[model samples]
Target: MTTYASGKIQTRWATLDDLPALKTLINRSIDALQVGFLSPEQIIASHAVMGLDTQLVEDGSYLVAEYDGVLAGCGGWSKRATLYGGDHSRDLRDPLLLDPERDPARIRAMYTDPDFTRKGIGRLLLQQCEQAAADNGFKTAELMATLSGEPLYIASGYHPLERVEAIGNGANVPLIRMQKILQP
Candidate 1:
């Protein structure tokens, strides 16, 4: 897990009430970064209902970054067994690419509010995910990163396996599958 040099960031478990703010963070991140990587319509529609927090509840793990007591970003992690759910995963083919039964943590729903970008909020949140996985007895954490999130994951010691392009709104949008292997 990569730790941030900055100390202004704080992370905590998210509650049900944080759903709305988390939604905004997800959508804003898409708007700021995905627009260029995807069509305007594809970006908007894919991120709209997909950002709803309820979709992530089954992941059984979530974390939020805060700046001055306000949410700056949120993400989720769970046991490695391809056990994941979200509006976005409903259509996933072979979603169980990773053995949820073997891997203790799968990271998903990562997003940092644009206003808080470059300030280490996303990095902190990712590190927090790694730590959470370790605390839960997992030796690795994985994520499928959006174009905008690739840099942060790369800088945080994540390695890319392959880039996959999917047909969304008739456009091919690329996503990277990454993982951070941790020592148990």
Candidate 2:
């Protein structure tokens, strides 16, 4: 738990009961923040292409942050091979468990409500994810960051690896792949 100007923030492992709230928070965050970086078609398509991966919840890797009793943020790290993408992604069919000794733990699906921006919710969630990943023997962390999210990840110690133009619903969406070595 933590407090900021926004209010008291609490985090917990996201459960099946939290799916609706998580979905709403994620879509709202993307809609509010992705403008100017992603086209409307791309945003709409990306929502379908990148909304809610149940695998994270099932694997106990997903978390939700709440501010004043409202869901403020959501994000997680994955032990599986999938790097990015939501439920509609074709790549989700094969969720091979990752070898943490070699493959970096994936920082996945981070979203914060517009009202809660810069209130420490994202940073807190990220810290928890990183610690959890390291505890699982991951030596590094990586994420496919949306343009709006790159700054946060960069500030949190991730460095850009490459620029990727991902295809979503026939639109090309630009994303940055970022990585960081976990502290032992």
Number of the predicted model whose TM-score against the real structure is largest: 2
List, residue by residue over 15-66, the lDDT tens digit for candidate 2: 8998988888888988888988888988876775576788899888998988
Rate residue 100 of model 2 by lDDT.
88
Per-prediction count of colliding residue pairs?
8, 0
Over the full model, what C-alpha lDDT does candidate 1 score relative to the true structure? Answer: 0.67
Which pairs clash in the backbone of model 1?
79-104, 80-100, 80-103, 80-104, 81-99, 81-100, 81-101, 82-100
- Writing each residue's lDDT as its tens digit, candidate 1 over 1-184 gives 1223347777767767777777777778778867666677767555532354453444446777888777788787765344323555555523343443366467777787878877877777777778777777777777777777788888888899888765555556667888888655
lDDT, candidate 2, residue 111?
92
Q: After superposition, how far is residue 7 of candidate 1 from its true place, in Å?
A: 3.1
Give the runs in model 2 whose Cα sits over 4 Å from its true position: 1-7
- Give all candidates' CA lDDT scores: 0.67, 0.86
Best by lDDT: 2
